[model samples]
Target: MANVQVGNGVHRKHAKNQRSPEESVTEHESTSMGSDYELNGSTNTEVQTDKYGFIGGAQQTPGEIDDVPPDVLRQREVKWLEMLNSWDKWMAKKHKKVKLRCQKGIPPSLRGRAWLYLSGGKVKKEQNQGKFQELDNQPGDPKWLEVIEKDLHRQFPFHEMFVARGGHGQQDLFRVLKAYTLHRPEEGYCQAQAPIAAVLLMHMPAEDAFWGLVQICEKYLPGYYSAGLEAIQLDGEILFALLKRVSPMAHRHLKKYKIDPILYMTEWFMCAFSRTLPWASVLRVWDMFFCEGVKIIFRVGLVLLKCMLGSPEKLKACQGLYETMEHLRSVEPRYMQEAFLVQEVIDLPLSERDIEKEHLSQLRRWKEARGELHCKSPPRMHGAKAIMAAEPPSRQDLQQNPTIIVEASQGHDSNIENGKRAKKSKTEKNKDPNSSGLLNPYPLATDQSQGLLKEGTLQGSNQSLSSAEHDTYL
Candidate 1:
């Protein structure tokens, strides 16, 4: 059984014997806990044997099993429950306090709900009820199905949630991935998305998990999991640039070895440290990431680099990318603890502004180097649904939809060929703005169109058409 040691902490098996770095690397390599750690341990009765004859579980309550002390766990539960109740007030008025609380750590008991709120999963889940089931009922793309199935057992195989081939955990994981395939057909399924969605499932229901996966893909880390993973490649350059400023010697040493940031940071950033950090650290990092955005990830990466290979001697000791990667993968449990790592990440001077500045600069450099077009940044996903609902559609979109703006165009005497004027009745004039065709130009209005979006039924519809053409757009 492989065990992790950190900061002179006791060596303990990770639920089941955790796989070593070598095993993970050789195995096509992949990749939690109860409420405390969002772990899903099985009772002894349910433990199943894999082909290798590895068994998982203990006699105690499966969800209650955790490494955190009982008092600490209780305290966190109480604190988080209070915050969860006043979530809206705190988020809107006491945001700094919220960030502080998140930096401390979200209580495991409330982590699922907290994450749902932080990632705006509730709105999305509500907007897409039954969609996951619809997608699941259909046979998925065979290529993605094969890849997802192969990676299922590879991720958190020791945990009860995903230990068996067809357990609820694995089943939920499948539904979430399938829903994402349905959600963003352009990107389809990426190997990296599985670990992320699996972690979300450990805390929330499958429906919530699906939305959280959507939030992560579209909001938190856009382009990171896309077809070419272009954002990830760009961030690799960004990470190296940041590394040079924070730890020049280590940066130079890695450069000397021709060890690219992709060799290490791909799994680190794409998996959001799920594959690199201990389970506890992964949870803590996620708590901050959900609250603080992607900057937390960069800060955590910097801190890990500084801790493991900050010293010239240590950097010199690593002969190649494999050694550097093994060193990172084998982080000591002591330093990897939530209390320790979270504080270090917080103390680091890395800021959102810094990350944004660096990202723009790096993106420009990348575009110039590759002669690629500079596409507009992805739409801001922070409270996106609510924001879209509150705001009116752009004039351009209103013009595009001839049905909604027919009278407006006539009043303006605009040269819109094939457009006809339609008069509104008193009842139409008194109708709500959303129902008066004003909001229909953009499909974000609350209506059946969002449901069509949820089920991916409108995949073939022309986006330029008016809201009347579809029930709504998301």
Candidate 2:
């Protein structure tokens, strides 16, 4: 019942494509078809809920019945679907001529329709291979060819690189991506396209890769590549916060050691963890991402942190920054894949509810921490800031603060007789000073004065007190 979210739904696109933002948010509601109550006073078996409205079918996961009548909701939903279908046709026809960028990793099957739906291509041809291919083959439009040729090898040149390098999977990747760049000039070449392009080469045909790539760029990547960076940074921050929350001890140790998890995870986000996570697991994360939008990313980040926290010895072995990154990256994409699935994972003694409890535990500790920040520092001790702000004489403290002071030795036969005289004179002066404190001539303790009448001599060893007491003066 409490529906709330912070990040905006609308994703911005490259300027040449759709001139506005595409909605990124998706709301989960009950299904819609119709109600059990019969409209004509007959026994109606239909059951509809608002959440299942999108599928235009009943909820796959049924729940306790609500108070609303299903038949009425179903009737309204039917009308709504018809209205949207008509609107989609109008919009598709309107933007049919507009060019855009290709997406990554042959867009998910569910995603093709979503992209076409969002682009208004649902009705006509936001994703028409036959027509677009004709447009490409037939050399009437000088502009389209000119743009495609210009970017033939500009951005994700997987195929071009293959033609140049002749290695593993480059040829197929290059072909599909280049084909897409040609078709969609507005979204011609973004940086993140490569990994996505690479992934697309796996499942979809080259042309499907091209169209799926289009959907991904338009709906998923969020704006241009630069805009993609912002999304990456935002996700990185959220992940860092989650890490600190889920593994406070590890986070504190990292901080104490001047280690930053973001340096490791930021690359994960910027690259879609393509290089880090196994080939399959990355797809799973993407599956959740496209379906649930960015919230799933936050959830995925928490899961990753939880994964790392599962073993400290394994984590500790990762010494350097890159070492830590490499280890996590090596989480055997298969094992990680297994980590999230299965009844054990669900019953793994943890859930989102447990995560919330962990988060609250952190919050409670944070509130109860040393929140009291007093300006008062070590009393009577010199601080750098104070030394800088004080008079010129105190400036010496700045340089002296970092210097090591050697303890001077004391006690000797010759100095002992002089010390007695000096003590007697000081005691007499102290009594008189009590009567006239202002006139007390406090002798300046000159550091350069070697009381033994020489510097660095064994003669002063007798004056040296026990080693235990020697450190007291310092």
- Against the reference, the lDDT scores of all candidates come to 0.62, 0.37
Candidate 2 per-residue lDDT, tens place, 146-261, comes to 43333323322222111122122333444455555566655455555666655554433344455555545544444424433433443354455556666675565456556555
| Per-model tally of clashing residue pairs | 11, 26
lDDT of 2: 0.37
lDDT of 2 at 50: 23
Q: Report how far off residue 14 is in candidate 2 (Å).
A: 27
Count of backbone collisions in candidate 2: 26
Candidate 1 lDDT by residue in tens digits, 1-474:
322211111122221112211122233211211221112333332234321112343211223224567567545655554555455655657778777878777765567777777777665655555776677566667677667767776767666456554444565676678767867776789999998988887776667788888888878788887766678888788888898888887778778878878877898899998876656677788988888788788888888777778886777657787787778777666676667898999888877667778888987898789867333337433332232343323323212112234223433324434344323342455553434333234443455446435544334332322322211000
Candidate 2 deviant stretches above 4 angstroms: 1-172, 179-188, 257-262, 280-283, 310-315, 318-323, 332-335, 339-474
Worst 10 residues of 1 by lDDT: 5-14
Model 1 scores a TM of 0.66
